[model samples]
Target: MKSSNVFYLVYTLSLLLGLLCVIFVITWSKGYRGGFAWDGSAKMFNWHPVCMVTGLVVIYGNAILVYRLPFTWSSSKLILKLVHATLNLGALSLAVIGLLAAFGFHNKMHIPNLYSMHSWVGFIAVILFGLQWLLGFLCFLLPCTPLWLRAAYRDVHVFFGLCILAMTVASCLSGINEKLIFVLNAPNSTASYKKLPPEAYLANILGVLLLCFSLTIAWMLLKREWQRPNLHASALSDATEPLLTED
Candidate 1:
């Protein structure tokens, strides 16, 4: 397929998945608790899913794709890099707030924290994400850093960024399953997998949509034509060429 066609297809799927995620979370929250709060109650827990879907999934996915945007090709590389870093910082901030909400709610309810597989993996992913962002800034964005170091770590940065995305998606899927099971097995509950409730279906669809979103982003990143081209010469020079610009 042509790169433009692939980009459009993936972009459309990303939008659909993002919309589905928001819709499902809002619907689920309203049907269960009517609205969200942060008062150490179950209502406060609503922020968990909402923030995760909005920040970690939607915004984070787009941050990774910012440079691949065709319109950005004409922009200065520094401007694109700044935009990318800013979006990631926003995502990290939201994810941190979501984590705090979850932990606060659990503590108030006398529920243990970090006991489940979802928590374990999610915690690790967040930690890795923070480190990745910090190192990326220091190595790539800082004016004092040597150009060779940035060049050396560029591939490493890309690798870890994709790894974090995969981990986040997996953690989200596990979290959805865990929540559904907990709700269905609660006292006097009528919902079950065999006779699934509307919420159950919504959760299932959300998971599928998230998976599709992640896959599309991954495909877009891997496509050669969709990757960002090196439009300017590096700040450091080899034996044959003169340095033209600093990133």
Candidate 2:
């Protein structure tokens, strides 16, 4: 198949996988972990997974693909950059709220924070993600940046973006795994994960879908022909062009 055709195919598959992961995670949170709420209950902690999956996993994954999508090719590069920033901002905002929900629940319950592998990995991933966004905004969006430097930074930016996304995915998987183990192995737990309970199936499926989604995205990113036309060489050349002009 042509690269374009393969790209569209993989893009469609990636979206499906991402959507599936989000749905399954939400289902696992609400159905198995108890319904979500804002009160100082386990329900509050529930928002952690919902928001994290919706924001960091799904939205963050989608944000990385904005530049690679074909329809965005005609839009002005500035507009694209703003859209990218906007999406990352949306993701970041949800992630912050998600963290607050988790931490608030923990503090209220007198639970220790940052004790688990999931917490450590998640904290580091979020910090790196924030830094990545700040650097990208300064280097790519700010017109005051030297063209030569922006050109040099662009490749570095893409590389780090991919790395951060991988970290985010790993963080999410570890979190889901940790949640399952805690819930299923609790003293008053509803089901035995060792017995292949329904909740276990749901959580395990969610993790698998997350991996599929990440792999689909990674495949598209690795395909040089699938990258946006002007993204590599020409985008920086026309950096200061007037509004609505393609870079």
Candidate 3:
């Protein structure tokens, strides 16, 4: 099959899987966990999972893929940069709200925060994501930066972006697992994850779909034929590496 065909096929699958991940998280949060709220209750904590998956996983991937879209490749570089930065800003906003919910719930319930590996990883990932977005904006979008210096930093920016994405995925997986163990296997809880209850299955499936969605995006980036051809140095600063791995 042709490269375009393959790209479209995987692209469609990535969209479907991303939507499914969002749906599954919402369902699991509303169905198994208490519904969402903002009053510093358990329901408030529910927003954490929903926001994290939708923002960090789904929107984050879309932001990175915007530059790779063949149709968009013809658009002005300034336009592309604005669009990319806007999407990332949306993602970061939701991520901030999610963090607030988690911390608020913990404080309200007198529960320890940042005690688990998931929390540690997720906290660091969010910090790095914010930093990456700021640096990318300063170097790429800011007009004053020297072109040569921007070019030099472009590869480094892309490398860290990919690393942050990977960290986000890992954080999500660990978070879901941590949530399951805490909710299902707790002393007073009736359900046991060891028995593979329906909620457990749904959350686990969500994790799997999230992983698949991320991998599909990575595959699209790694396919050299899909990259825009002969773009100007300014427009394709990260083009130095094929895998790109995009901000």
**TM-score per candidate, in order?**
0.90, 0.93, 0.93
Write candidate 1's Cα lDDT for 1-247 as tens digits.
8777778878888878888877887788778645888899988888888888778888899999987888777776667778889999998998899899999999999999999999998989889989998998887667677667777787799899999999999999999999888887787677775578887888888899889889989988888777766523432321123222333
- Please write out the lDDT profile of model 3 over residues 75-189, one tens digit for every residue: 7666787889999999999999999999999999999999988999999999999998998888777766666767777878878878888889999999999999989998987
Query: What would the per-residue lDDT of candidate 2 be over residues 1-247, giving only the tens digit for each residue?
Result: 8778878899999899988887887888788878888876899999898888888878888898887888878777778878889999898888899899999999989999999888988888788888889988887776677667766777788898888788878888898888878888889987766877899888888888888888888888787898878553555564444333455
Lowest-scoring 10 consecutive residues by lDDT in candidate 2? 238-247
Q: Which residue pairs clash in candidate 1?
A: none
lDDT of all the models against the reference? Answer: 0.82, 0.82, 0.87
TM-score: model 3 vs. ground truth: 0.93
How many clashes show up per model?
A: 0, 0, 0
Instruction: Flag clash pairs in model 2.
Output: none
- Evaluate residue 218 in candidate 3 and report its C-alpha lDDT on the 0 to 100 scale: 90
| Cα error of candidate 1 at position 117, Å | 0.4
Return the top candidate by lDDT: 3
**Where does candidate 3 stray beyond 4 Å?**
231-247
